[model samples]
Target: MFPPGFFDRADPSPDHFFYAPPRLVTHIDDQAIAAVGVLYQELGMTGEVLDLMSSWISHFTDPPERLVALGMNQVELAANPQAHEWLIHDLNHTPRLPFDDNSFDAVTCCVSVDYLTQPIEVFTDVARVLRPGGLFVVTFSNRCFPTKAIRGWLYSDDASHLEIVKRYFEAADGWAEPVTKQCIPPGIPGDPLYAVYATAL
Candidate 1:
């Protein structure tokens, strides 16, 4: 068995919940969406980017030359206007990625980091696929499928969740200094979302 806190085992069978669902909705609200744009602005535009764990939409404001998406559902990825190419795969089943070393200029995982059961290995692979000085970005909100979210995530606070993603960057050996951003839209009437980012070491 995996370590106690490494993953939430109560929802061990996410495929059962994931396979049949098709939520054609954006997880974050308008304010949060704008906040993502602001975050992406800081990331800078004009390079190849990989949208890891992407869905029906990618909140990237500035268009890049190439945007690739790797997701669980092809329909969702196809619906994403920003993705030029998409691959369907479950990272929980295979933490390894199929891309060559230093393939992407940047990587973005949006709103789906809480579902990972094998984050460390995935983070390591992300580091391997990114070019030197390239970036890895992870964004998440307070919304998730309750039955599918892991037990650890279900009980954790917003601060702890940010720390969890930060730790993923830290545990990945080749990541440069990682920065965590709190996406607290001022005077917003909803759950708080956060973004954590890092550059390749």
Candidate 2:
């Protein structure tokens, strides 16, 4: 378990107030963006990818051949030029994903893991939907809406955040050992960019 009271303090209102109107902006700074780009390049640029909790702008500098986005807001998903296909669904409402087993070659959740109340189960489901040797990558920075982010995420330190996400992979059962990275670019302000990624067993 992620510890009781971890996600107990979030507002109960529909996430629409927080996400209904599209902000249409990148959450990470320019330096951080470059770091993410480097990480993506390292991940390689082939096969179908599922962008979980996707938004109007994916961090990648170029488009992939096949990109599928899933998220809560339809308008935001619709506006994203990177998405080859987009599906509207709230993962918080239904953590059991609708995708077929072993479907995606790679999966990404960018800056949105803080909002998940059931991260372990969702991570387990991620492994189920990923093909053998498929990668599940989660990236985040310090920027977040404190009121909307889950309770556990609101107070956790950066090192603890890494451990927390690592635990998600561990609890998922079928995921191989995760590789943790701090995507820091020189002279960037605020917290360093971080990603915890692993291959499916």
Give the Cα error of residue 183 in candidate 1, in Å.
2.3
Candidate 1 lowest-lDDT run of ten: 1-10
Give me the candidate number with maximum lDDT.
Answer: 2
Can you tell me which runs of candidate 1 are displaced by over 4 Å? 1-6, 14-17, 185-187
| Model 1: pairs clashing at backbone N, Cα or C within 3 Å | none
* TM-score, model 2 to reference: 0.93
Error of 2 at 162 (Å): 0.8
Which residue runs does candidate 2 get wrong by more than 4 Å? 185-187
C-alpha lDDT values of all predictions: 0.82, 0.83
Give all TM-scores, in the order shown: 0.92, 0.93
